[model samples]
Target: MTYTRFAIYDAPSDDALAEFGATWLGWDIRTGCATDQPDVHGLDDITMTPRKYGFHGTLKPPFRLATGTDVGGLQVAVTEMAATCAPTKSGGLALTTLGGFLALIPTGDLSGLERVAGACVRALDPFRAPQSKADLIRRRKAGLSARQETLMLRWGYPYVMEEFRFHLTLSARMPDQDRAQWFQTAQANLPPLNEIYAIDSIALCGERADGRFELIQRYALTG
Candidate 1:
């Protein structure tokens, strides 16, 4: 059995992402939905991927398990970790352009949200398996800065801790010429992000045989 660990999201349920994904990305890229598609672009298409998983920031960053790690033990640890952290009550987010693609980003005070995300990343990092040589090479293709490279070397992912940004993606990258048009369309259709969006829980997601993601468990923050 193969397993990949995700920080779990608290946004809309699996069904929601699937429905929205079909309309937004022209494909149903969520697990358990009537449709499923591969993540052909990987992190290159951050906007669409996170939205398909629903809204939530990454904490431990997803990873495939090492040969010896126990899946059950990892799940137990994740549940315990979630129980100790309190939910964030930052103001709602807004739809905006990030690196030329559409995303929903925090609008109001986000100190609390950042704190929760950082804590989760640090606490659950022990469970992350090291990146493979191919993975490392792929990450390096982004021409990471020194800090990003350092984080990648230490955490098996380039963006975390100091480099974290809370966002839900909406599309693939676009050319500069088309950016304005895309952004306008995205802004028009997206929900108003200015309201307070609560981060009450974290979800555990799993990849299905067809390469789409599915929610396996949800852990609410009790602290």
Candidate 2:
């Protein structure tokens, strides 16, 4: 299949969490199909934003392939990079509201996760096409700091390396008054939250013509 863009993600390997995420989002990115969502009121509207990408934490943001690079070469580079990245563990995950949106975020020590994210951001960057001028303008509208601007220019994304915060989004930005209700729904529907979020593998995802991302491959961290 032809892909317009590619990204690296840390998708859930745990069956329960994976299933819950796929169902909740109404898209099984791993399987490249839509899922039957639960009949909860307003569930579809709230999840519309994150449904395209499925349940995963971003290791590297999406980018178009560079002029000379192809998916095959990209795969080889990812494999080689993964071989040098030892698996890392995090304190765990928690369902929380982040800047008005619901998400699963890591708690406690994040150094290991940070290291893995940093490595992915740097090592595979050669395959990333430079951000378009409009893209840069859109990013700057978020009021970037000097450091963020530098990172954006260098990495084509401002939120990488020191700025990276791993999260699995569960909903669109909702009104503050509606936050508690959605949070409760998410909690009730979710599997038991992880007590130890381990980074054992990373997935290569491709954006289909329909704009939904689908899992292409998962590379284990063996180093």
Instruction: Judging by TM-score against the true structure, name the best candidate.
Output: 2
Instruction: Kindly report which residue stretches of model 2 are placed more than 4 angstroms away from their true locations once superposed.
Output: none
Backbone clash count, each prediction separately: 7, 0
**Residue 138 of model 2, lDDT score:** 100
**Predicted candidate 1 versus true structure: per-residue lDDT over 56-124, tens digit per residue:** 445556776655766687688777877788888776667677887777677678777777777766776
Q: What is the lDDT of residue 12 in candidate 2?
A: 91
C-alpha RMSD for every candidate: 4.7, 0.7
Clashing pairs in 1: 8-203, 47-169, 47-170, 92-195, 92-196, 92-197, 93-193
Off by over 4 Å in 1: 1-7, 13-31, 34-56, 192-194
CA lDDT of each prediction against the hidden true structure: 0.64, 0.95
* Worst 10 contiguous positions by lDDT, candidate 2: 190-199
Q: Global lDDT for candidate 2?
A: 0.95
Q: Write the per-residue lDDT of candidate 2 for residues 63-151, one digit (tens) a residue.
A: 99999999999999999999999999988789999989999998899999999999999999999999999999999999999999999
TM-score of 2: 0.98
